[model samples]
Each structure stands twice: as structure tokens, then as C-alpha cells.
Target: MGLVKIRVEGVSKVFGRDPAGALAKVRSGMDKTRLKDETDHVLGLHDIDLSIRTGEIFVIMGLSGSGKSTLIRHFNRLIEPTGGRILFDGDDILAYDAARLQTFRRRKVAMVFQRFALLPHKTVIENVAYGLTLDGVAKPEAFRRAGEQIALVGLTGFETSYPAQLSGGMQQRVGLARALATDAEVLLMDEAFSALDPLIRHDMQMQLKELQGRLGKTIVFITHDLDEALLLGDHIAILKDGTLRQVGTGSEILAAPADDYVARFVRDVNRGRILLCGAFADAGLIAAADAPVIAADATLESTFAAFAGGAAALAVRDWDGRIAGALTPRRVMEALARI
Candidate 1:
């Protein structure tokens, strides 16, 4: 059966007036509810509907204050919605009591914040073990599992070092390790690499993709960077002013944006690089033997040299070296011209 790991149905959250606080204000003659009616309060998130499939990397991208963080927080009930249903594996999370919510967070979901959030005094191993320790795992076993997690995130030699001793990238690795150590099925990352330098951030993105491929965990990543969204997402949702602009696979969004906002956002994207080479094909229209060959999955960066070699068409081969398609220079120019 196809399963949805997390489903958000018309979820909406508005701040500035808690139910208890509003009642208290009215009891004290503040008329807070009426005052709220007169004010232009911020809506952190409008009615949002989404479904994240199991084992997929779903990305939410938007400018700051566009509700990306608020929407992500709803997945794990970090911020309860003002209206609508959040279902985890088909169970409504809003129905959970405090204790059950804690259980759900500890066992089924884990979040990694942008700040790393590592305990300053704790060694990397202790930091990773903190969650299990809270659940009453034995010290030896917790440390053993923590070490394996540290190694999994590329922190093998730094297990005994304190957070302050590590570089920013290394510290973030510890944060990732802590999330992995929880053994949670769903991971929520809020701008996890935004704090790093470009080089470090690029490396971390690749590392995360590799780690995800091996682990196959369901992940929801939030970011404002278009390139990051393009690089890491299996499916992407673009948000503007607390509303969804578009949701689609990278190629789908690039090939045909849903509206003006999404089109403007990706106007400068190198379509040649982003579009799949296999997509530019006619079934059974393989290239001639004398044509230059490029891997079917090759990025535009890899195919540019072949395109400049004056061949009428280039042979596109899949991993098996069988002719899967052909790429024409005219098609490449056409795709690139869309930007």
C-alpha cells in the first residue's frame, strides 16, 4: 500500500491571541477579541494543505516570513494549528495529549534546527546520546549507538570533542548525528545549511543526499534558496505570503511554472542544467554510431563540450551504455532560451 507519512489538511495558524489569553483579557475588561477584529494581525500561515510521501525528500521554499518555518513546524505539532488537521500516518496529531505528543516526537519525528543546538559542555558522543538517555537507555548502549551515528554523519574522529572545538560544518554534522541517533522516521530540517559558508553548505548538501539515499528516511527540508531547493528536493513546494504558489517535481516546475510568482522566482535558472537529458527524446530515435556520446543523466555542464563539437546530434547512453536517447543542439538552445 502507498503510505503518506505526514498529511496536512487546511492547516492554519494565526498568532497574537491565545484562547486562554483572550478569555482572560475579556474578563479584565480589555475586549481583546473585539480589538483583534480591528487590528491587522499577522497571519503566520494561511490554510495550507500538503501530503508528504514516505521516504521522499520534500522541500518548502519561500522568502523570509512566507510561512515556510511555520508550515514545517506543524508536521511534528511543534506549533499547534489554529485550524485544521495534521495527520501523521493517518492519525490526527491534534488529538494527541501532551504525553502522547511527547511520545510521538521522541519515537516518530526529529527536528534539526539551523543553530546546531548542541549542548556546549557535552562531547559529540554525549550530545548524540542525550535523546536516548532521556528515554532511559543505558549509558553504554547509548554511547555505542551514538558513536555509530556520529560516524554515519562523518564525525567519526570527533566523537570525544566538545561542540565548541569543532568547525561550524562539524557542529552541524553533530546536529545531524543527534537527529539520526533518535532513529526517527521523519526528519524536519529548518534551513539546516543556511548558516554555513557556500563551500561548506555545498558539501553538506551532498552529504545529506548521500545519507538519505542510504537511510531512506522521510525528510521535509525548509529553505529560501532556490538552488538548494532544486538540488535537494524530490518534490518542491513554493510559498508566498503564507500561500502555496506551486508544488511539483523540479523539472515540472522548471518546464512549466504554475503562475507568475513561480515563473519570476525561477526566471534565471539554467534550464539546460536543470532539465533531464532523457526528457529530450523521441522513442526509438537513437543517435547514429558516429554521433558524440553523453550520458543520459549528464548535466548541461558535462554536455556543453560535446555540443560544441559540431555534431548534429549527440548519443545519450544510460548506465548500461545502451542508446537511451539523443540530444540536439537546437533542443539545448531552446531549453536554455526559456530563462
Candidate 2:
């Protein structure tokens, strides 16, 4: 609920020569598939309305061709929209000409790709410094800044290694480092961790969460995996066939799905992992609370581990260590059942 960093209003994209007619048809209640089949116009997005908050991880998730990638490209104007407009910090992005758009891309935002887009010939240090170099930072100063980012990403000694010499995860870290070196206000990550192995992907997810907490960068992350979105996103936007289906926190999405598509999508999800400790706590049940105090932000997984020895209820405390609410095993199970 801070200031809005990016606002997308009534955004729609149709890829074809005669987009005006197709868009008019769409507004008249025509669907995307029928339009494509009957009019030969492809609908890449339809009325996408989103507000990305400052310094928060806003995740856009859907299967391939769902317009998740296309929607994000508009943040940096990579793909010109057939209709609608986007606002960044109150400035109209769509109205920017070539020079202003270039400056916006260089200073306001940096992107990390699905593939590790590192230079095969350049050393890791060189790749990380490339963005700064492009912005006209002197070589010595650029290297100094890039070296700090490389260390921040835990790739200190391997700065001399080439992309081929590093592992997939390491290369991905290089991509992250390169983006960080730019010192941009926002990070647009399009399925950045999807290419890694499952274990490595999870590790990267945790690292990104920690880094976000420390750096407070506004990150717009794209993903196809529901679990990854639930784990990493402060707010999640679900897209289906180029249309937005739902937008809310993970718990909100789980407790109340907006439509049948969303309901079926989350029907088999492991809800226990995503539910937080705050969900199970009820202040009125203080007398029933018989266990140790736990942090309000702790997840059910950690609660289970902490109370593994018994079935006692726990007392939840706020950041200042003051009693906030009471938690019970039964309440936790009941919350999971609702999901």
C-alpha cells in the first residue's frame, strides 16, 4: 500500500495489420480464440489493469502464451501496445520518444532473462560491468561498482571465469549481478529462475527474497509455476489466455479464487506451505495457547517444526515481542482445509 510505481490501464495488444477492427470486435464481446480463427488477428493481451507497488515483488504468472511476457515488455516499452497506456511514477511511458525511452530503460529499469544472457567471451566481471559501461561510467569506476555487486551475489573469486567455465546457477547469478550493477529502481525478471534445476531454483528464490528485503527494489517477476509465485510474490496476478484472472496475495487467492479457472488451478496446490502463522492465530484463544511464542511472520512450516514435539498451541508475537495472537494446531489444520 505504498506509492504506485507502475500503473497499467486498460492495456490491450493485438498483433496483425487490421488491429482496429479486431479490437472493436473484442470490445463487442468477442473472445480471443474466435477472433484469431475468424479474423486472423492474434490477441496478445486484453484490458490488463495492474498497479505495481513501490519496492514490492509483484508476480505475473500463467502458462506459455498467456501474455505474461508480453505484459511485462510494456514496462520498458519493448513491445508497442496497440491500445491503452502505462504510467511509471506518474509519467506517461507510452508518450516517451526514442531518446527518453532509451534513458528510461538505462536508468529506471533493468531486466533479467530466462536464459543466462551472459557474454561467452567476456569474463564474469566484464559481463557485470557491461551495463555500467554502456551508461558511460569510466572503466575503473564501473569495475569497482560491478565488483561490489558480484560480491553481493556471492561470486567474488569467480569474477575472472568465463560463462562457459561456470555452472548454470553461477551464470544466472552473473545475470543478476549485471542487473544489480546498473543500480536501477526496478528489476523486471521474466522467468529468471525457471531455467535452473529445482533445488537451485528454490535456493535462488530464497536468495532473491532476502536480497529484496535488504535492497528494497521493486521487482516485477514472471513465472509459470504456481508454487514459485506463491513463495516469491507479495502480490500475484494470474493471467489466462492474455486476460487477467485474479490479483491478490497468495493467502487471499487461496482462500477465495476469483473464477473456476483459478479455483481449478489451485485445487491441488500445497496450501500448508503458503499459509502464514498469522492465519492460524486468534487473540480470543489466548487461554488455549500453551506453547512458546513465535514471530507473526513465521510460516506454518516453521511452526510445525517448532512444535513437533507436542500438540500445544502457540502465542504469536509482533516484531516488538508483544503478544499479538494465539495459535493452535487445530486452527492451522482448519485454515488448510479452507484452502
lDDT by residue (tens digit), candidate 2, 40-82 = 9999999999999999999999999999999999999999888
Choose the strongest candidate by lDDT. 2
Query: Per-residue error at 115 for model 2, in Å?
Result: 0.7
What TM-score goes with each of the models? 0.88, 0.92
Clash count for each candidate, listed in order shown: 0, 0
lDDT tens string, model 1, 51-154?
89999999999999899998998888888777779999999989999999888888899888888999999999999998888778899999999999988887
The candidate 1 region of ten consecutive residues with least summed lDDT is: 19-28
For model 1, how many clashes?
0
Residue 169 error, candidate 2, Å: 0.8
Please identify model 1 stretches exceeding 4 Å from their true place: 18-37, 282-286, 292-298, 315-325
lDDT of the structure predicted as candidate 2: 0.91
